[model samples]
Target: MIVSNVSFGCTKANSAWCVSSKDGHLEAAANRSLSPTGHLIVAVCLGFIGTLGFSNNLLVLALFCRFKVLRSPINLLLVNISVSDLLVCVVGTPFSFAASTQGRWLIGKTGCVWYGFINSCLGTVSLISLAVLSYERYCTMMGTTEADATNYKKIAMGILLSWGYSLLWTLPPLFGWSSYGPEGPGTTCSVNWYAKDANNISYIVCLFIFCLVIPFLVICYCYGKLLYAVKQVSGVNTGMGRTREQRVLLMVVTMVICFLLCWLPYGIVALLATFGKPGLITPEASIIPSLLAKTSTVVNPIIYIFMNKQFYRCFQTFVRCPNPSFTSSFRSTSKTTKPGQKSRKVETNNISIAVASMGRPSTFIQNRTNSNGEQGLSVKGSKPVVSLVAHYNG
Candidate 1:
């Protein structure tokens, strides 16, 4: 009969060899009892969905960077978000997938530490970045004059500070101050919450509150204000501009909804894992929650591409830039007109020029023709010419 050998912390029976035995027994039981098919399905589904999101985000960043016209302070934050999400998918999710499937740490101790550190760091940084984005959107939507160049600089600085915050939380695990490693047979690497050290518990709690909860609160607050401002603006405008304002509001609402759906489960799981009784949440159940946490990285790209027309247009332009045939097709479509056109139409293009002078001066020009075909100039800065009729007899 299989016996439960798990114990909390280092008891008298706990030693390197004993720990190895416990691990081996767990591995044997997992291998004998667990079906590979289910694990494979879960891994594939998570990986595919996560990769799709990451790829979309990367496409956004690539398109934005490729076109100079698309560059803006907001786009800069988006580029950072895309880069973070890409790293999460390319580095974090794969490690997670392997760990979840194998039910053990195939990698060594160092690999475990590095994986845990990077996973936490990237997750925290992504959350903080999202909060910053919401605030930036809030400023833009509210039409705050204070949201100028200096404020943009502050946003950039805030992004940098997020990285620092992430590093602060992740570095402790590397130094042996906190226990972070494989939690169970199927769990390849994570913080060892089962260890139940007071210091570890405190550290985890602090990290959770500051990194996750605080950032989420900030995001909600900023987006809330943004929605209110949008509503106020919508009440005043009843034309195309009102429609545009409503669209922006819808996009922000969608982002917040997606963020909540994707991250809430993970946050609950993290909290449970930190404080709840052991065995209350199994590793298998935690996999989905963890997958949901990672889903945010991929979701951002989808949101931007589908919600923003300008981004979509820029993406299309960037993708089609390599194909000469596509350009020819576009040109052909643009130049085509109706056949059998009758009369030539006169087209006048009115040009408005804004001239900046040291003292601020303005002038207007007008041309007029009298009944005798005499032209007159308006005093400001107008000039006219008279056409003379000549008759030649040969």
Candidate 2:
């Protein structure tokens, strides 16, 4: 008979707690002493929240890319950030949640290796992307117009370096330089951070420095410079419309705040897990903290789309067609021909053509004469030019 395994280790070895011999070789049931209900609840909540953040960011990225007007360098980087976060949420979080729940890995050796590799790689990439964005904003606010050809090339190189850095941390396990295996209470997979091996400790330390500390320092420095630049430019109107520099400053501040909030815990935990003595903190506590660290991926998109007005407007335009009333009103206001000059149907068709070529010189209007027999001069003695420029660049 199959019996619960918990009783087998007792001094009086209860038979009811022991499985029958015919059931084959039995490993002891993993300890559930630390599997508190509250921990599970938190894990599930984080997983759901992370998933929502991931989905929102993905939607924003997709909308931005689909519209030509939204394709700026800043938005392009934001898309990269969102895609990284999406992978973390869509690919990483579920494994994390499962590890939290079962407290032991249900998936075996190969799954553990893959999950750990992806989790580390995505986390590294997200951190680097955040740093890149922070630096970009800092440069833009400082009026540093140096981001021309050389800067773009550098940015591209930086992206490649970030991936290479991530792979550097993630690939060693495949070669056995470091180990990734199931943690106690087998629901999650991670680097064997607490292993007694000196190589593991060295690898963990290197990962923390390259992946976390250095990036954090770069982001902090860039954002600090950005804040100083914003203050310096406080009085100067950049003439880019009513949206003040303060608004962009606020966005940057908000992004930095969220990044710190979401990531600080994970960084602390990793530091402690790597250098501190084992048994100081249980694996259960680390599980939630680890999940929290990865939540930044999903959170980045929400911050950009919801907090920035320009991004929101571009997002709306990209996702939905222009309002019918607005389109019609625009056509009427820009129409070139007199309303009574032609049949209603012909007038309508002409209006469409006029709207289509609103700013360009066209053959249809080349021979048209003004009341003074000049080439359609306005009262100011200039051509009655029609200008229609749509400004949707984010």
Best by lDDT: 1
Mind giving the per-residue lDDT tens digits that candidate 2 earns over 35-124?
558447746776786678677877877777665434444556667777777887787677657655654344545776687778778877
lDDT of 1 by residue, 199-260 (tens): 76787788778877888888888767755554543432245226646675677679878888
Best by TM-score: 1
Q: What would the TM-scores of all predictions be?
A: 0.70, 0.68
Badly placed stretches (over 4 Å) of model 2 are 1-29, 32-39, 98-103, 143-154, 183-185, 237-249, 318-394
Candidate 1 Cα outliers beyond 4 Å, as residue runs: 1-34, 100-103, 143-152, 183-188, 321-394
Error of 2 at 315 (Å): 2.4
RMSD of each candidate? 14.7, 13.6
**Cα TM-score of candidate 2:** 0.68
TM-score for candidate 1, residues paired by index? 0.70
